[model samples]
Target: MTTQHLQNRVDPWGQLRTVASRGTRMGNRGILHNDANQVVRPWKHKRWVTCMLEFKQIKRPKPFSRGNYSELFFLDEATAFAAGHRPCGDCQKARHLDFKEKWLAANVDAQLRSAISMDDVDKVLHAERCVPGGGKTTFAATLGELPKGTMFEFAEAAFLVSAAGYLPWSFDGYGPAKRIDGATAVTVLTPASIVRAFEQGFVALVHASAGLDDPAAVASAQKNPS
Candidate 1:
């Protein structure tokens, strides 16, 4: 029998899967060691973080080795943000700074803007990512009101709302764009604060299927201006 590895792909909802694509980076909560290389615990702490694949010439750890954190992968930063993770300060300093700057500037309230720390942001994200029972926390919004890179649920499926259009999200990749001009209120899966960051012009890198390069699609998106 093949031994399952603890390394797995993480979706926007924080669910783990044994998909083929591991993306470009590795993420972790904390050390999750066991005999079977399975994620025995949901997470070790609230400080979930994403790190660069190569950092300070550090060597890759043995996959699912004893006394190491469970490895998680994401398609990109957008996917990581959607999954309620922040950039690692050590390995991803530039991204961490950028994220912090935007996160601070997006908060209009003086007290919140000035007093927040990475831990505080993680706390808020933790609450937004999971519910009391065991699912993601979601809110309702119209398609036009949501910014690009926001993920939402409609008709029992998840979609990534980009400038071009809504792209269906799956474990493999994003599907073709679907126009949502007639869409009413839908359940937004991305956390409210992160959505506000996108609204403030902090762009997240989306998958190629977002159709960001097509001129006609860009024009259509500009006309709609979501």
Candidate 2:
């Protein structure tokens, strides 16, 4: 018998779901699950973060142990960022620092101080990525203004903006590329602040499923189904 999995897989919009595949990265938003092993809340704190699946070869056979932060999964770093999660300072120190540096550099201005803490970052991100009650915060942007690695909602579906074009997102993997007009306005899934980080040279790791070239090539692969 197959063991049942919980709803821990996170999408670009930060909603959780149960999927057969456990994505590339692990994350946490405090203890979201209850003693019954069911996810009871969206988040417990503002320090939402993503980490490497395997850190220092450490393993947790039980991902949602009692009193422990619930384990969350993401398809890739881009998904995590779009979900309003930054790199974990503990498990992903280097990336955390890098993200912090670039994030501040991109966001800070004459009104803000050069030195800021992660808590401040969390506060800003929380305000930008979530609504007062419950919902992912989104904004409108034209395709050309959005940087590569940004995710956007087009035609009621989530898609990633790649160097070549926009690739449709899925629980299984990304689909064929669909090039659109650069001036087309769309709802961006990634937070406005984090999108600025991307503009400041922060690069997100996309899944290899998007490695396929142009639309024709990806379509051909999808048709062949190797």
Candidate 2 structure quality by residue, lDDT tens digits, 165-195: 7999886578899878889999999999899
Those runs of model 2 whose alpha carbons end farther than 4 Å from true positions after fitting are 110-113, 212-226
Clashing pairs in 2: none
**lDDT to native, each model:** 0.72, 0.83
> Compared with the true structure, what per-residue lDDT tens digits does model 1 show for residues 1-226?
5544344677877677675665644688776647777766667788989876667779877666677677777665567777777779998788788877887777547666767888888888889887754477878888888888888888888788877678888755578888777457998878888888888887776655565542222222211100
Range of the 10 consecutive residues with the lowest summed lDDT in candidate 1: 217-226
TM-score winner: 2
> What's the lDDT of the predicted structure labeled candidate 1?
0.72
Q: Using lDDT as the measure, which candidate wins?
A: 2
User: Model 2 Cα displacement at 123 (Å)?
Assistant: 0.6
